[model samples]
Target: MARKTSLKDIANKVGVSTSLVSYVLNNKDKENRVGKETADKIRKAAKELNYFPNLNARSLKTNISHTIGLIVADISNPFFSSLARTIEDEAYARNYTVIFGSSDENNDKFIKVLDFLSTRQVDGFIVASPEESRETVLGLKESNVPLVLIDRYFSDIVVNTVMVDNFKASFEATNHLLNKGHKRIGAIVYESTLLHYQDRCNGYLEAMKQAGIVDGTQFLAKVNHQSLQTEIQEAVQKLIFEDKVTAIYFSTNTIATEGLKQIKNVGKKIQEEIDVVAFDENLIFQFLDVHVPFVSQPIKKMGQEAVRILIDQIENKDQGIINVLLKATLETKEKLQKVN
Candidate 1:
């Protein structure tokens, strides 16, 4: 293999000292009082020599790996996949790299990934923590590790977090269904201890209460992550047949997809037999016979804020804790005709 080009090679070609080349390549020329013309020549020579800095050596000297670890619940899920892409773009724009993993909503796997990323010497972490990972989050905080929780977080933990106002999002979705004459509406959600899920459930309950429904909990169904499809089908059956609900609210996109499938299996059509609203938008909803309305979270903004806050924590140890709750909008094709 050909030898790797080095800064020394660029320096020799430019007839400059290695330190001057380092200053220009590292973007420290202005601070070091190097002339702009000389800096430009150094940059030109470095490009011509195809010189790539040794990141490992630089990291060892500066104590910054310039890499972040991102852990989400499920990478295949469209919401998370989109969020990850946005984060990657934002991080790249800021000259940082992201290494991401999926926890599969398992606390043990979440901890393992955390440990693995920590060993890789990541500068910071952005995580959508799994249920029952309170101690793990606390441990990271206590260790002074730079972390920013995204999409999900523990309410009791005092740490940096960037997430949507799930409660409001759910409440608006539930209220939208109610406005369309869906009094006996039901909701399907994961049976997780994560505060984001709880907030969503609470939002639905509160909206039902405000609509004069005495006990909305009776219409609520919780499904486990381990048996998602099966549980969602069962929940949809019970809500439609037993509870006699005229509409359903799905808390997550995965739940919405499975519930819609179950609805089709039972020979029910959206907005015809039953109205429906989902928390996160999905492209599939648009192609259906009748488009489904959904709560649209600002995914790009959430990812950008998470990276910004985590990088801030990594670079500024004295920065105060930050908690950001972004708003979500209810998106629909058109106002639905009132149910008879």
Candidate 2:
């Protein structure tokens, strides 16, 4: 392996003492202990040499790992990927590095990831999808491992979290479909015990009831991740052909995309025979012939808040748990008329 650039090398290149170079690079010269010209020369040489700080060495000196563990549902999904990117950028600005892992919404894997990160001495963690990992999260709290949940949270856990109000978001999105003159609406969601999904499910039910559609069970379908394709096809066929549904509300972007594909395979035109309103936003929705309505949360804001909360806990800046609830924005391109 190629040798890495060291601070000593920068000091030697600039004809300065190693301690002086360290003071300037670490920005510890606020007292003007080192001359400005000398500092500038050290910085220039460091940049020229592509100098990078050794995190391990710094951890030993400062007792701060300066690394954060980020565990999310699925990084491949646009919503999670975009949110993770925002969190990473925010953490970088605070002199922290981000290490990522995908839990695939599996509780066992999520716990394993947390343990592994703990072993590596990460300062804290920003986690999402805590439905089945209730005990594990509670354990983290008991252990005083600084952690913040993003995207999903458990009321039973008493932990810091940053997320949009899933219930209100889903209710508004479902109401959007209802306002477009579609009475027979179907909803597709992930089959989970998580509060996030349950909140969305309740929101859809509330809207359907408000619209005088009492038969809620017939219009909703839930599927696990392992059997997404088959279940999506089955749900779409049943909802469209058997139930004569006019529109569908997808609780997430993942479910929406799968539902769209199933609709196409069943030879249906979007907004013509059926309209859709998804809970999360994705760029792929723009390319569709049908103007798929979508709800977008403050993804960047949530990410930044997660980092700030986790860092605060890690530094003992906050003594109490913080729960941040944000709002969602609905984006619409076209409205669907009632099917004759």
Candidate 3:
């Protein structure tokens, strides 16, 4: 094993021309019409010899690599990790390979990943978490690159997106607390720039306004993505001690988990002293001593949908954007209480 297996090696074993083997392996011969028997033989030989086509060579010939690039922000996040698994599975099923890249919320890294994927000549792209703008996405669109947006989407750039309806989900979560006799409801939000985060804030604002709770000075707190736990804990203390917030709604998992830890750290009774509801569901539910409601997003569906959209675009070269706003479900363990 000095070198990897090649199409020529498989062709030699099958007693066929390299071009014939290439066509059969790549599935590029429509007029040549490869026979099932010949195709099967070629495939069997390739499999036995562990012959994998050189993607570069195949790409040069067909201008397609049967591969896709997936870019996500913060793959460490459980939500993104779960989505990545689902997308990889879907890509495997379609005989397409996937390469993953993480931006880590850095604009320069995001641009670099886009450039890398483009230079590699990936057949399509599944973009997960774009920072703020869609200049990169728009550039891909103009170049006729098959792109599928996932997790978060931008209205300005017309690309197929698969994500949960953040506004409605957050609204429902807020309304749940409102119906549960919680008047002074506080919120712990992640950073700005992300559309999902903004939608979540908008939902909270709408719910609070509808309840005629106008004074929002101490009711809202926004925490940066990094060092979220400390910032959220400080904000929660402010809401509880200074502003006297009775109950709190968390916008996402990272914030909710940290806020929960802070509440317990302060020796406050969760159910009795402060009630809580969260948007992102996690294993934290099992550890909680009291009933807590969580909004569950179909993360696996989002991943599968991203793959579907990308493959469809690659096959059909579709121009119109397909926006899929998946619905969210509320999982509640406590009885609903009526608020005055």
The number of the candidate with the highest TM-score is 1
lDDT of 3: 0.80
Model 3, 212: alpha-carbon shift in Å?
1.8
Which residue window of length 10 is worst by lDDT in model 1?
52-61
Give lDDT tens digits, candidate 3, residues 119-194: 5668878886557545555555555667787878777777678889999999899989888878899998977788
Which lDDT value does model 3 have at 303?
81
Overall local distance difference test of candidate 1: 0.87
User: Which digits, one per residue and each the tens of the lDDT, describe model 2 over residues 1-340?
Assistant: 3466777899789987788887887777656588888888887787578565443343344467789999998888898999999999999999999999999878767766765665567887898864577766665665566788898887777889898988898989999988878888999988888888899999999988888988787899988878988999999999999989999999988888888988989899987778888988777887887688889889999998999999987777456989999998888866455446
**If the candidates were sorted by their TM-score against the true structure, best first, what order would they fall in?**
1, 2, 3
Better of 2 and 3 by lDDT: 2
Clashing pairs in 3: 181-339
Provide the lowest-lDDT 10-residue window in model 3: 52-61
Residue pairs clashing in model 1 are: none
Cα lDDT listed for each candidate: 0.87, 0.82, 0.80
Give one digit per residue, the lDDT tens place, for model 1 in 197-230. 9999999999999999979999999999889989
Ranking by lDDT: 1, 2, 3
Cα-based TM-score, every candidate: 0.81, 0.79, 0.78
